[model samples]
Target: MSQQTKSDYVDDVDVDDDWDDHPTDDELEATVENLEASGFDVEVVSDAEEALDVLVSEIPAGASVMNGHSTTLEEIGFDDYLGEGDHDWENLAADIWSIDDDAERDAARRAAQTADYFLGSVNGIAQDGTLVAADLSGSRVGAYPFAAQNLLLVAGVNKVVEDVEAARERLHEFAYAFENERAQEAYGVESYPSKELVYRQEGTEGRTTVVLVEETLGY
Candidate 1:
């Protein structure tokens, strides 16, 4: 068999021709509004870079922040910009299941529990404003609910689907596959556990905010 090089893999990839089935701008606008009505604060942006700027500006100083493990956010350079800031922010960027020391994991959980704001990405969000996420490590979804007083979700247009059914399909078919690849590349782990098992974790009561960018952001 021929050895598959990076360029060879890239060259062989076929793009999905699903654009023709995409909804119109008016439909998207109505969907956004409906999302807001369903108890989610949603903001629409033109691009990933703009979304990052808006996210940083919206967070106040002296606020603790928690981040989800998201390749999309990293691709857009959120960590670089966030690291440059001189605010009271705590980073919860650890593998959910690989914490060897209980004390260390406890400290990380405490930081998240006390954060003033939390930032993460959603696997999929429905037109009616339901946020969907699949996790193997409970960190990302676990910290979402009560980890902070305020919650901010950064999502790309690629993360949006028609409804819950489509969201679930994307989760199993696309989101999980991409997440597995990411985890392997970043942490050297191939598999963790059932995505459905991790999805059972729920966030605590907090003001949830979402920023949806027009461009593709994450898996």
Candidate 2:
């Protein structure tokens, strides 16, 4: 299947555009500080290229890597990079997709949660340092809380919100609409927030990193 960009679904979805605006410098800095205080290693990048570079530099060679569906990663060119880039890491996503049998492929997906590095994007980020994301199935969030040995979350500043409640509102009212439309277009199936995760703090040290790009990206 071909990769779809945000432009492919943006016109079909109705959402409050304000939720997709880049945060002010003060808001960004405060959010970074709070995220750090909450035990999440936060990296602020000026643009998508810088974010991609940081993402690439985080993982070591030969490690098994898997990622959930993330338009932000595609926007930054990481999806194509991981799929075709010259890297020694074991691309579990590619491996899982190559499976022919339905049951085997499903099992591979479940087993991939333990991949050395699991990468994905967050739907909403609260300035208070909570990360909110939802998935029609538990595929994406299943690795975020603790399943994966390490997690890499890449998101644009547009995802930042006032608090956990605001984050959830953004997810339910804004991100969900865009995602549902995208799902219908891509998979010919409707999507919903059937599973949601509210991540407040990380107990494991150096196990998770949040890359915040200054540009507006993803839902």
Candidate 2 lDDT, 1-219, residue by residue in tens: 687777787788877888887777898899999999989999999899999999899999989999999989989999899988579899999999899999999999999999999999998999989999999989999999999999999999999988999999999998898888888878899999989999999999999999999898898
The CA lDDT at 158 in model 2 is 94
Give the worst 10-residue stretch by lDDT in candidate 2.
Answer: 1-10
lDDT of 1 by residue, 125-164 (tens): 6665566776786666775656467778787777666777
Worst lDDT 10-window in candidate 1 = 1-10
How much is the lDDT of residue 183 in candidate 2?
89
Per-prediction TM-score to the true structure, in the order listed: 0.78, 0.98
The collision pairs in model 1 are 145-203, 145-204, 146-204
Task: Report, for every candidate in turn, its global Cα lDDT versus the true structure.
Answer: 0.63, 0.92
Strongest candidate by lDDT: 2
